[model samples]
Every structure is written in C-alpha cells, then in structure tokens.
Target: MSLYLEAATILESPQTTSLKAIIYNPSKPFKSPQPKLYALIVETLKFQDILKEVVENSGILKLERKLTPLLSILLTHDLLLTKSGIATSSGPLKDALLRHKARLNAEFTRARLRRGHADIKSLIGAVNAEHSRESEDGVTKTATGLTSFNPRWVRVNALQTTLEDSLSSPTFHAFQEVGSVSDMFFFDVVRKTYYRKAEILPNILAIHPSHDITSSELYKSGKIILQSASSCLPAIMLDPPKGSMVVDGCAAPGNKTTHLAALVGSSGKIFAVERDRRRADILEMMITKAGAEGIVTTLKATDFTTIMEGHPAWQASYILLDPSCSGSGILQRVDWDISKLNLPSSDTTSSHPSKKKRKRDETLPNGSASQPEERETKQLEEEIQDDDTSRERLQSLSDFQVAIILHAFLFPNARRITYSTCSVHAEENEHVVARVLNSEIAKERGWRVQSRDENPLSTWHRRGLVGELSDLKSSLEEQRRVADGCIRVHRTDSLGGGFFVTCFTRQVDDKGQFGGGIGNLDIVPAQEDKSRSQVLGDTTEVENQEWNGLSDEGPNEAVSAVDIADGDPRSGKRQKRKPGKAQQGRTEKTNRQFQKGRKGWS
Candidate 1:
C-alpha cells in the first residue's frame, strides 16, 4: 500500500502485470509523481545486478558528476531518498545530482502536482477537446488537428528514366490511381514536382484519383523513388558546376545520396557515409532498392571528418551535407481530434478503444481572410505563439547546421557545396548562412555564393527569411547572387516543403579579389536627385547603371546600356515591387535592420 512497497514491487518485475495496468489505465490518472521519472527509476532498480557488479568491481567509492545522467532518475522517482536511503561505499546519491536535484526534490514535485493529473479521462478529454474523428466525415482544409503529414513524390534519375518518360509509364498511372494529386508545375522537364510545400494541393493526403500513376509494375523498378520534393534541391544545384565526384555526409536513408549519384551520372563517384550500423544497413538496403549500384558506395566510416586522410579521392568536386534536422517541417498527423473533449471514467480498461481514437478539444477558426475587420481580429487573437521553446529548438538545430556547413569545406577541392534544411527558422537558415559567410576560413578559402531564384511556396519567405538574406555588400551575398541567382521560394507560392538551399563555388581562376573594393552592405547610393535637385533620402532609383558595364564576373558577357523609358525592359531604371519571398523571409527574421517589420502575417 505504501509508495516504497510499490516501488520495490516495480523493481522486482519491470515487466509485471501491474506496471502494464498502470501505464494503460485511462481512468487511473497518472498523478502520483512524474511517470517518466518514476519509470526510469524502476528500470534502473530492475537492472541493479549488472550495475552493482560493475560498480563494486571498479572500486568506485562514491558517484559524482560522471554518473549524473544515471543517478538523477533514481532521485526523481522517490526510489532513493537522500538521508533515509541505502548507503553505498560513498555517501547517498545526492551531491553530483545537482542539476536535477532541485527539480525532482519531492517537496518541489508535490507542490507542482496541485493542479496536474493524467488519468484516462484527462487523456481522452485533452484529445477529444475537438471533434471526434469518428463523427467528422468531410475533409478540413486546415491541418489544425494534424500531427504528421507524409506527402508523396517521385525521384527521376536520368540513368533510370527521364521525367517525361517516367510520367508516361503505366506504373506512374497506377500511382495516380492511389491518390488524387494534381501535376506539379515546378517539376523538371523530366521528373519531380515540388508539391509538398507549394501546398498546391489543399491537403497533405491524396484522395484516390479516378486514374493513377503506378510505380510498381513490369519493365518498372524502384529506381524512381517516392521521395519528398523538398529533398531534391541539393542535387538540382548540380545544374551548374557539374562535379567529377561528390560526398554525402550523413547519407543514411540514401534518398539524397542517390539524388547526388544520379546527378553525377556514371562517370562520377559518390561516397555516402553513415556512422550508425543499423541506419547504415537501412541505407544500403535503400541504395539497392533504388538500383543506384556502381554509382554510390556506402561506407560505415566513423571518422568521416578524417576519411580524406587515408584515401586520395577524399577530395571531392561536390559535397552535399544533409545533416539530421528536427522533423518539425512535417505536416501534423491525422489522429489529432482537436474538438469535443471525451473524458473517460475511472474503471474503463483502456482496451483497444483509446488506440482507435483519443477524444480532444480544438480551437475554432477566427474568421474569413477576405474580411478586413474579421482578419484583423483573428490576427490579434488567433495568432500562433512562437514561444521560447520553439526558438531554442531552432537555435540548437541551427548549430548543427552551422557545424555541417563549416565541415563541408574540410574536403579538398570541393568546388561546390550546397547546404539546405527543411527548417523555416532563420536561426537554421539565414543565421547559419550568415555565420558561415562571416567565418575567416570560409572567406580565406575563396568560397562564394551561388544564389538563385527560389521557388515561391514557402512560409519562411513571407515571414522575411529571404529579401533581407544578405545585404548586397557582404561577400557571401555577392557570391551567392553570382551562383544561385537570388530567386526566392515560398511554400505558399510553390509546391515543396519550406526549405532553404544555396550553392557556392571556389574561385576558379583566382580573380583579382572580386572587383577590388565592394563595401559591406553596398547599395549603389541611390542617384543624387538629378532632376529636382532635392537631397535623395533613400527613395531615388539609381539607374541599375552598374549592371550595364558589368565585368566578366557579372551575369552576362555583353556590356550595353538599354535605352529606357519608365518601367521599360530596355530602361536602366529598376521598377519597385513588394519584396519577393527572399526579401520577405529576411524581414521576418530581423526587421529593425529593414523598414517593413509590421506587415508580417501576425
């Protein structure tokens, strides 16, 4: 009956009938202490034999900082009280548990427990706070209740099939039958439709179409993979500076690796490295399934950072770094029932019912977007919260991104490097981009940007991750403009995941320091009010005069000024329009640096 007695029982049989009973009990609120914390404590106690053996034999007297991660669990679960608990060779399991001690101290936990209880009824009530999926039949355009959305796509490898040929396949027809999806416009002439982000479709799931594109059939193989369209951009950068060899860091799941392999074709070699053995196995299987043999070589190389030290071919022409990122970009799943709370009674054995559907509460839509008053009210009250937790996650994820970008350069002669993440966070996108460009080594290595027109279907842009990307004065900005061409892509505007990608090239001919002296954040000072003789305070349009007599380094080979009238293509004067996706994305991240911070989709 006592808590300690029950704890002992749990330790005796980690997989006892009683433990399962508590875990699956819907009516029995999980109110006594934190379950996650308690569960970990019981697990450690259950494995005491092995732990004791190691600890005793190792001659370790007291546990301290090194054992903190393991010790914290016990302290939190109430399994071991400091002064009253068993004494080991050292003292009680207390000191080194500093970080979690304050958190798990019984007094603190019980104080916090005044209002939080997790019984079957609470669980059901939370999920069914919205409409019951069992009751709702029509499709909802908003993904408000969804937790995960898995969008479908196709990968077209030239060696296997051209985009045009693949679409005509009988298999392609079968796939269409499985789902009702419109053809993606951003697709290449041969294959792929950047469908997910563009959200060209109303929802993530595909309704069975009247006709279909079957991917599995005779004369057909898995070479054409079902991949996320957002994952395809890294290889697309292969459109230029075709490399002789490439490296895919963290290439497990093989989709991106295979894309690179396909881009390089048979003549080029690709090294796909995965450190985890189990994941490496999966990668190998995917590689085989996709028929990417001879093109990609899978490696279980742990020290990829130093892989180049041994083999001479370690120096690659192109390196693609798709490090692991949070799956935050995924559309939510369908089990979410955001309306209609369904509380369960105390004795209802959780049986097979909760698995089928947990009931829940949901938020109602604010109003019509077309109505200004309604939209304004909704904007103020229904605005999504970008809390500190989400921001921290963005920052942590960006750190990994920055690390990978910096590491990509370790390979010698990697002329082109493309960095991308499915994250819309500026911390992950522009911040990382900014930090890498500012690095002394990146600058010294002669790496420059390859900016291009991004697709118009991403939210990050509307939020301002693009336009304010880099002031034209920064070397990275100039270099990127030279490479990728500075086109912004928006998920709302295009059919792909909210993704950020840009290419870079090493100075090929060692040009004379990129046009002598370009200032930081350069905006050719708008023309001095030539006509009115008024002092121009930023709004004057300078003839994109610098564009006319561009050096060989410029976009074109020709150097002729066009005769101009207002808004004419021949006119040197640049017409102003709202900032494209790129500009919008930039403004979203940091606006005090720019003017339009208030126009955001708040």
Candidate 2:
C-alpha cells in the first residue's frame, strides 16, 4: 500500500490500539520506515486543525470520491507542509492529488490568512505557540505537545558516571547552562538551547521538554536517566547509608531502585521486588542499563507483602514503597494526546447526502457503531477529564497503600521506609500515611514520621496537607508535625507531575527490641514456624555459595530464593555450603514450594 494509505489506516485505528503500537508492530509492518511514518503522522496531527479547514474550503474531499478523510489529510500534509511533495511514486492516487495541487496550495494560504497570519512562517509560529500554551495548561485533549512548561528531567547516573563528567561530555556541548529550573520552561521555536542544574536534587538537570535527550549518546550509554524530579524524591528522602541493604517494595520500571543503588554504591545490596512478570523484566532491564546489576538484585514475581522473616529482603535496613494508586498525578501522555486527534471527515453532505448518513451509522474498526457527531465530540470532551480519582477507587487504593506500608513496618531490621505515590488525591497520600501510622504494627514497631527538620528535602516548599489528616487519632500538634514531615508536589509545580512522599524512621538498639521485633510473631502456628525455619536455612545456604551475577537464563528469568543469598550478616563473609545430594534436593524442593506460594499472592 502507498504511504498515504498506510498512514490513513493507522490514523483510523481504534483507541484500544495505541498509535505507537500500531506503527511499530512487527507482524503488520509498513512498507515505509517506522521513524519516517511516525514523524509524518505526528506532524500531520499537529497541523491537522488548519489542514482540515483547508481541505473543507478547497472542496477536495467533495470532488475526489476515492480519497478517504484520513488519506486526504495525510496527502495534503506532505503536499503543503513538507519541502518535498508527496513521497509516493507515480500512481492514480498521486496523479489525483497532484491534479488539485494548485487549488490545495491556494486554500492553505487562504486558511493561514483567515487565521490572521501574514505569511506561512507566522502561521507556523502561531500554531506552535498555541501548542505550547495548550500543553502547559492541559485544558485540551492535545495538551502534552512537544513543548511545555514541564521540563524534561534528566539524572546523571552516578553508578556509571559523575555529574561533572556527564556535563563535560559531548552530548551537552551545544547546550547553554541556565541558573534555575524556571529558565528551562521558556519555549524557543528554533531549538532548545538551555539546561539548568537542579539545586534541590543532586546530579539532576532540567532541560527544555522539546529537546529529545533520549537520542543522545549519554542516555544510550546509561550515563543519564530520564526520570521526573517528583519520582526521585523518595530515594533522596530515604538517603540509605552506603553498604546498607535496602528493599524496593514495588520496584518495576526501576527509577527509584537504581537511584537507591547509586546512593548505596557497590558495597550495598538492593533487593528490587516486583510481583508482575512483565514489569519484573522491565525492572531487570533498567537495572542492567543503569550499570547497577552488581549492586541491585531483582526479585522477580515476588510480592512485597510476602517477604516474611525467612526472606533475605527482611534483613534490609531501608525500604522504599511506591505502591499502586489512581495515577491521578501523572502528566498526560504526549502519545495519548496525538491518539485522540479529531481527523477531518471526507464524507461531505454536499457531495453525497445518503453516503454521509451511511458513514454516520457505520461500525468503527473496534466493532462499535459510530455515534452522532455531536455525541462523539461531547464524549471526547468528557474523556479529557480524569475520572480515576472517584471516591470508591481512592478508598480501595488507600487501603492497599496502608497494607503495603504496614508490611514494610514488619521488617525486623528496617530502620527507615519511604512511602510514595503518583497521586494528587489526599486519600492516597496523607490519608494512607495516617492510616499506616495508626496501625498496630506501626505503633508497636515505633515507626514514626521523620521530622521535617531532619529530612533531606526540608528545603522543598510544599508539605503535606494537614487538613487531609484530620481523621487521624492524634493531637493537632502531632498531626501538624506529621503533615510537615511529608512532601507534596503539585501538578503545576513544574516538577513534571503531581507526587507525594514521606519518610518514616525509628531507632534500633543492639537487642533490636523497639525497632527490630516482628509485630505478630506470637500469632503464627507451630507448623508455619517450621516452614519459616526451612526457608531461612535454604536462603542462608544460597548466600554462602558463589556470588555469581544474574543467572544464565537471562535477566527476565525469575531469581529463585535458593539462587540468592545475602551472606552471613554478622561476619559479612561468604562460606561455601557443605555438599550433600539429599540436602540439596530438599532445599530445591523447598525453594520451588516457596516460589509457588509467592506466585499465588499475585
């Protein structure tokens, strides 16, 4: 098929299939290169409004019966916007498009003039300005444009390279340095030129959102990571000591896991736990890419709540929990904006009255009958308003969030834990924090909110909303202190997205009485105690064995409990396990049974 036809097919795809997935699908590959196809689609969508006006005014769709609305838009984009005309070779479609080239060009110029532009250049600038404004305001469906106030945050991976070395690298040679993050917000149509070193977070740099840093050598080499400032707060707040063991409770797509690795250095060990198989694969890949494979161990298909007394992760001194939430605070995806474009229609009533009616009643590609134009537009408007933060959903998420944190509190060796979410709702943030603090485990283990004065993010202006914590059974003064300890980033804060994070700390004595004891140890049955002892024995044996890196089965493969060991905690030394066929067979069986139980939790 022609490039125009292929582009049209992709544009007409149902909302269920993302534009990227359809364009990049290997099974149904396009004749044209994927990158070229993607660029054409994005550029066309950006200029679609003006192109739609031009096409309708020129009456090309009315005259050309063969051209679909999507086809005409794609062909018209190439014919007018691009320097070179249509990319396809001589054909009936090409011949037909070229036949109306003069009229199309005239209509485009007239459309530009109608929009109050003196020339094409001014019209382009105006459209770009509107695009940037809309992206920052996030008031329209196409809100996350190429340029916006939300600066692209890049963190120099200390595991691979230092911030000073990364800045001196050739990747940033063309860029000019600015004094503040606010400077990165100003959009320049020609090019993105300025970058600001973040004062609030170490090794973080904010750059113009328009700059495609992923294409840089530093990013590809894993020296630089694209992570939001809000997401980085949890690790910074936890500030795990070097050589300390840490656990990331929900460590998939591991931005915080790798950050923790960077802080702990190679001497420290990090257990990155992820219950989902697919997401564990992603976490492993990220850990490998960030050059933290040595410092970080991925716990694949392992639920955070399932880490009992026998698990190696139970010995972690620090834990970071970023649990599932409504995701109400996340920035609208740029691809989502493009996918929701309102493509111009080819079925003009003037040309074919019956055909227009038939098109209205036609079943869409996803098998849903098309609605009236008015209803469709209204539905699109409604979709722009996020409904995921409904009361029922928030309460469910709050309960889950409290449960995850309560589990973290059960860690016998845990000294600190940070709970965070990409949610703007109070129920998921302060409410969950309050609920966890009020739990019996939290009070018994002496897990209290780390004071604002002691937190590394003390200088950050935004703190938790005290009003949200009114339900807590604590003094107003104590409630205010807890609220002040928490950090909250607003969606419009220019930190990239809405986020909430708070640290909890408790002092541990030598005997581990106040901070180290498990909350419900007496409630467990005798049979369960035997199983726990076996699990601990198998884990200890694995730790004493050779310290080889990820298994030969590839990073995505689940790392069995018997395959990993933290070594003797007191001596901090590796001792080879005594060889015995019967003992090895029993250990293997136990590991398999333990894995089965963990999978069942998922």
Candidate 3:
C-alpha cells in the first residue's frame, strides 16, 4: 500500500526545500526486524516532499503533515501477501534500512543547522512520539497459512437470488442466527472481519478460498455482480427516480452508474460521464455487459465543471459524483520487496564512495535540482510519480466536485445530486459540500438537502454558514450534520465506501418545468412486471416446498436434510435471532469497524 502512502505525500506543499525520501529499495517483502516504517515516514516529514508542497499550496498544511506520516506507517508495515509468506527482516533488509536511516539523520542534522531550531525540534518530537506508539502498541502477525483468510461475506441481491441458496453450498455453516439488515452472510472459518461487498455489478458472493469467481460462468453471464455494500450506500441515499434524467459526474468504469441504472430500471436516462477517453471506453464495455446500454449514454467529459455550460446533451435531474482521492479508505495488507531489506556491500560495486549509493535516494521529501540536477531527471520523475499527490489532483477535483454541485443545482428542475468520493478527507467531501451550499449560487437556485434519510418522508431543516460546518444550524442540530442535513458516510462506519453523499431537491421554485425532471417518464409496466415475476416465482416455489412436509414411514424413509452434525461448533446454540440474511449483515457491521484508508482528512 506504499502506493497509498506515496500518493498522499505528493500533495503536501512546503515553504522551504527540505529533501524528504521514503526508502522502499527492498525488492521483496522486508525480512522481520526492520525498524518501523511508520517512524521513518514521520521522520521523512523533516524533509519537504512534493506532497507536502501541494497540500501547503492548497492551504491544508496540517492535513498534509498528519496524513503523510500515517501513510508512511501503513506502507512500511502492511503486506498484501499469500497465507504461506510471512515477511520478516533478513540481514540485507536490515542493512539497507540502517543505511537509509543514517542518510536521513545526516539530512536532518544539516536541515536543523539551516532553520529555526524550535520548528525542527518540534518536528523531531512529533516523529519520536509517533515512533514510540509503534514500538509500544505496534501490530503483530496473527494466524497464517490456514489462519490468514478472513471470512469476508457477500450478498445475493434480493431481486435475483435468495440468501439460503447462496449458503446451502458446502463449506459454509449457518450463522443465520448472527446476521443484520443488509442481507449478508459469514463463513464459519474466519471470525471477526469487515465484510467485502460487490459494489458495481450484481449481487455476487466471494468464496473464502475462491478468488477466481470473476471468470466463472455465473459472473460472465451476469447472474451475479461483485459489489460492496459500502459502495452501494450513495446510490441508496440518492435513490434516483426510476425514469428520469441523471448525470453521473465522475462516472468512469461505471460502478455507481450501472447501479443507478439498475435502480431506475430501464425507463430513466443516465449519462455516464468520464474525463479520460480510455476509461470512458472501458466504461462503455462495462455498461454493455450489464445490459444497460440503451438507458445509459457514455461521454468523454474532460471537465465536469463545464458539464452543463456549453453542451446540452441532458439536463440532469440527478447526479452521482465519486471523484478520485487518496485511497486511504482501503483496508488491505501491504507488502514490500525482499531485496530492500539490505544494502549492497561497498565491495559489491566500485571502491569509490559515490559508487556505493544509498537506497535513501529512492524517494524525496521535496523536489530539488540542488544536487545532480540534469543527470537525475529520470530518477526524479520516477520518485515524483511514486508519490501520488491527491492535493494536486484535488485542486481540480474538489473544484470539479463543487462545479458539479453548481450545475446539478443550476436549473430548478435538477433536484437530486449525490456528491461522493472514496476519500475520507473532509476537504474533498464535507468541505466541498459546504463551499457550494454556503455560496450564493446554491441558495438562489433553491436547492436544499432532500430528506437526510433514504426514506424520503423523513425530513430535517438544516442550512450552512461559512466559518465551519459545526456553526451551521440543523433542524435537529447535530455536529455531524451536512449543509442541508444530508448523510455523509465514512469508512469508519459500516456499509458505504469511504464516501460522503448528499441528496438535494429544489425548495424555493414552483415552476421550472423546461429542464428534464424525473416526472417525464411514466413507470414502464414491463420492467416492473419482470421484477414481480422474479420475486413471485421464487416465493411460489419456496411456498410449495414448505407445503410438502418431510415424512417418517420406514427404514427407507430416513431423510438427510442439512441438519447440523453433533460435532459442529454451533450444533446446540440457540438465541432470539433476526431475519437470517439481513441480520447477518447488520450484526457484522456492528462488530467490525470501518477499514481506514492509510491517510485521511484529519
């Protein structure tokens, strides 16, 4: 996940040129005994990097500093590995790290000599405290080989498959007794886990040991979709009308776009927009596969800010925006290269001092031509690219989010817009929402938070002011309140990816009918009838089975249904349980916390 770390750091902006570097020279996962990478990342802050520079320029100095350090910690320690491979620090890994450490100390010493002693000392103190946390409460390896697999659950959509059908297959035990409202299930093997959902496609399930389901017959035929419940939250909140004009502002590779299309059935018009041409092409393929080609239109939109300015393809009544962000919300293992554990011996290369270079050159705190300027352009480029900067991308991205909000609310008929991201950053999520809601444009347009709850009838009166979101007034007056009292989902919560979604409707205007509103299309009878058939067919079969009871006649009549064997762990357990599928999801959600992205808004 250094990709997650490097991506966050490049966004930081610095006032002075302090060289910062992350030593990831290990070509393989680090051997055990490697000093905490978290501390190294914190210490790296002593040098300025492109990430820090961008963040400073964006005026999120504090966030840049805080997030970059955390990203470093996550990258160094985490490993996305197979069950058989347990990484540890070997001699080479240790030596490379030690050499890198030496270079950083020397750099810090030189930097201290040039700057304010107080500032330098404060940074060092922060680094020390961060390292101390790692030393004391640092993570340790748990189960492996057989134990490493977490029993992540997957759901079969109610519209297609039944929960019982997904679980009746062998290797799964019924914890139907331990479930929730989202129609989720758990494997008997791995306990205590944050479940993964299939977000974009269909109601597909993940097998504990099976990772090749994507190429299977069912997935290829569109019988199942791989989507996460967290990813499903925004569309849940927006609940776009079945037949209306909708705009997916950042719709590329159409996850939410297809979801919106599915929810709308076939009557609605969904314009799936992507800025990148290649991504848009891929999105079209995805749309075609999902059988949603007719209802959704694909476009190569370079700037969503001007989505409505010059082009008049569709006056969007609803919009879904899942903009790019630092992938801090991802909760997966991180693995490093084994070779990075050790540095090459001096004799391995030339006897000259410069000939034996340090791995510290792999990354930098700040961009500088101060040393070997012209000769190392390629090296610098590689280093810069390694650090993915969200601030630079977000400078345009956040503005794009705001611009989409403006356009969504531009016409009186465009009532619903769901602004969301995979980022946990408030600057990208809540702040962008606040900026638009507080501005005169949103107010004059008469767009306000449509019920904060997905239930539509649930209402709350909330409005925004500039100083901070907390100062704003909500009809219910809660600190977590959005500008118009919209619900913003965090990765720290159960369902919904690290995202922020706010549904809006126009409040002031009565007649702005020219723009295409959701009222345009009458419900398509055929689409509804097909869904009704799916439900009725399944239900009727189950009812008929129930009507035919098991028999007890003679020795040949002995039946072997899936009754629990006495040796099974849950054989005798009984409790007041919730509905099987729904209960499984709700229960797991409560027990497991949200997966944190390596770095975030804080």
Model 1's alpha-carbon lDDT is 0.41
1-602, model 1: which lDDT tens digit per residue? 12333343344443523332333242444333434424344334432322322232222223343443233334333322233432222333444443344433433333222214232223222232232221111121221222212233445656576655655665554333322233421122213232323232111222211112232441234445544455566666544233467777667666677667666777777777665554555565555545566666665523234343234335676777666554333222223211221212223322122223211121222222225444322221221221122665555566556656765654556667777665444565666766777775467566666534432222233332444456333665454444233222332222233455666556654553332122122322213312111121111122111111111101111110011112322223432222234323432332232213321111
What's each prediction's TM-score?
0.47, 0.60, 0.46
Off by over 4 Å in 3: 1-212, 301-313, 336-396, 454-497, 508-602
lDDT of 2 by residue, 1-602 (tens): 36777777777766564455555554565777765676678778778877776677677777787777777888888889778878978887777778999988888877666555565655554454333322421222222222225666778899989988887788776677776555554332213455553556898877765454554667765688777778889999999999999999888767788899999998999988776675666566667667777777777666666677566777898999887776666665444455666566665443211222222112211122224554433232322243344686566566666767876877777889999987777888899888888878777778899999998899998898798899888999999999999998765566767789999998566785556354445433214423232322223232223121221111211131111223321233322222234323433454465676453322
In candidate 1, what residue range of length 10 has the lowest lDDT sum? 553-562
C-alpha lDDT score of every prediction, in listed order:
0.41, 0.66, 0.40
Candidate number of the best TM-score:
2
lDDT of 3 at 63: 24
Give Cα distance to truth, residue 180, candidate 1, Å: 12
Candidate 1 regions exceeding 4 Å error are: 1-151, 173-215, 218-220, 240-243, 301-303, 336-389, 453-496, 510-602
Which whole-number lDDT from 0 to 100 does residue 201 have in model 2?
87
